[model samples]
Target: MALTDTAIKKLKPSDKCTATRPDKYSDMNGLQLWVRYTGVKSWVVAYRYQGKQQNISLGLYPFISLADARNETTKIRNDLAQGINPKDERQKAKQKDNLDFDHFAQIWFEHQQTRIKPHTFKRDKGVYYNHIKPLLGDKDIYTVRLPDIMAVHDRLALQGKTSTAHKVIADIGRIYDHAIIKGLAPNLANPIPRGIHKSLVEHKSKHYPRIKITELPKLLTDIDTSNSEPLTKFGFYVLCYTFVRTKELLGMTWQELDFDNCLWNIPANRMKNGLPHVVPLAPPVIEILQTIKSWHLHDEFVFFSNRGKDNVLSSNAFTVALKRMGYKDKMTGHGFRGLASTSLYEMQYNPQAIELQLSHVQGSKTVRAYNSANLLPARIKMVNDWANVVNEVKQGDFSTYKAKSTADGNEMAFISFLQSLRYKEQEIQDELDIHRMERLEVLAG
Candidate 1:
């Protein structure tokens, strides 16, 4: 019976045991709220589960309002009329705990933490906690659709974090897989299916701007003369000499440097290839190392963070220095590799030797697996020569220097021909005279 105002207001319990409603209360279909013998009022829905009449408690008074109780009771009645057991269905749903995207995401993050490096795990967690979780955390994992993912993508794009959006979507997909595997949610469609990123986001190529070979001397000189911080100057020197990745250089430690042997042993864990690398030090590199050594009394890192001994130098310090030198968009820390590689090739060093110095894989298939120990000597010489070349350029010595061309011998033939003509002008004139006489005779005949 539908609840009346008088029934709601005057609802009270009776002695012994009895169930009664106000005179104004009259409704059909599902059970209604009634006070028990103890005077505690609660809602009950009369339904059939597996062909037997049963009473399911909706909830207690005030907690489940009258309107909500009625609505829930109606739903229970509809479920019973369709030969469905509402109690069994509710139990099945309750077993899964109605896990939402955020809850399962925490599980996913914990699982990922074991598989990735600490730094990488921190970054992934930051993306989820700072961005993804706030937007879709409360949504049920099973109910999170493509539109919802796309909405996050669109918002992130507007905020100029498109690449982050792509990564977040990928993370969300992994979280869903975790939910499925753990039985927290059913196996459904991944919001970010294959090729979906292209339609929803624009792809931008990462720009790696390198300093011009001839301009290196002036640039380094300017860097040295500038009133920048000592750490900034040292970072620039390290980048120019080592040609290691920016992050690796920023994270360098005093333990990694062997001043006696003049070598920097970058450990495998910090390297992209997961292989320990040996870098031969040049005179200038050793000089910079000595300078850093004088400054470091007890710190483990060669580049110590200003904050404390435990931290390394900031990653953005070098980029900021470049920007201060008016090279904001013209060069970057990673661009040092490109400069070194191009300059080494231009100096006629063996390609494999240069690649080895850069810690790159030599070749494909069998050659890659076959690590040659003989290249160390050649790499040492190549690196030294590269350093000397950079020093000379930095000292404003451009005599006998030429811009490095990216073309092969065949492509350079025209350039060689043009250069040769300047010296062989008389020989070219005689050949042209002979050709002109032959053409005139043919015309006369």
Candidate 2:
């Protein structure tokens, strides 16, 4: 017979002297309420496992009611049939309670800090604390469902923050996947779906505005004759010759250049892809650097600010100079990259050599390492040929010089021709400046 709640309440304990052992009233198979001489009542289960009789405490009476105790007894009977101990399962549950989502996420984030760049790590940590922690921080790792994660992701999309939403989803999946690998979240699938990005509108890639190759000569001539600072004029030429990004060129230091070897090694942090890039110096680039070095030798930065030697030029300074020269939106500081990439490909240079000089990342890690090591010779020839082709663009003459595309192309012959002309013009500008200074002094006298 099963025990009723009223009948169990009415039962009294015997005196300690009379009944030394506790009295038990059975509800059904293995579920019992044991009453002590002191009137303390508790629920217990008795079952046979591996041909051995075992007993486990469920809970105190009232907290574990007669019906609840009976339900637990049924679950324990199933566990015993499956060769598992109910007591051990309960202990595991208690341990899992400590490994919640928030706790494990912090541990995972700390481990990630050592592997990624400092700025990237800072950004990820900001996202976790600001967006992720508030929504799913307290969820038990084993109990977090797919729908719960989807709710957070959809909310971000609705708020028009698709990029953040995408990163958050990836971050959550990574954390959960790590947890699963460590055996901390068994039987719990990663809640973030693989096709989650499909739900949000994709971000479009932006390309900078650039001039056509035919019009490049006119633009270069305007830059050379512009009434702006001489340093600004040289800056425009360096961008054309090197085809490096604006930040990489503007922040260049004197120490980064190897004039003897004709190479410029940009450091990892300054590069957009966070890798060191080697640029072969063309004759055009070397001439511009030599001119700037003669004028600003004390400054550490190649393009030092007008205000002080310790400071570098402003990022917007070149853009403002372009607008003054009437090339607003016609060309940008970044446009040189596109212009060079397209023209070089048209000129039939090696695609791999051009890409390496542009510092564009491609191929697998192993393949990229091999390609980077062997690209220097090809790149040196490519840069020299490109410089020679651009050097022939006279202000009034639209006739283009067809560059000789060969590994052994001679740009030195063209460089020599241009060097004599450049020196003659420099002498004329110097004489004019001196004459003007003398006239001003004569007027003062």
Worst lDDT run of 10 residues, candidate 2, spans 405-414
Question: Candidate 2 — which pairs collide?
Answer: none
lDDT of 1: 0.69
For each candidate in the order shown, give its overall lDDT on alpha carbons. 0.69, 0.74
TM-score of 1: 0.63
Give stretches of model 1 more than 4 Å off: 1-97, 181-187, 272-274, 305-311, 359-369, 372-374, 399-445
Residue lDDT tens for model 2, 1-445: 7899988877767564223578888888888888866455678898877778888887556646788888899999888889898888878865765667887786687678667775577678778877888888888877888787767777887888877877888899999887778776567678676786777566433446777666776788788788867777787788888899888888899899999999998998889888889999998799889989988545688988856322666667778888888888878988888677655654566777877787877788787778888989898988887777677643433233333232222223323322333435454354335434433332333
Find the number of clashing residue pairs for candidate 2.
Answer: 0
User: Please, what is the TM-score per model?
Assistant: 0.63, 0.60
Tell me how far the alpha carbon of residue 86 in candidate 1 is from the true structure, in angstroms, after superposition.
30
Clashes of 1: 4
Residues 170-271 of candidate 1: C-alpha lDDT, one tens digit per residue: 888888877767776555556667877768676454547776665577789878988878877888887888798877887777888888877888987888
Residue 408 of model 2 has an lDDT of 22
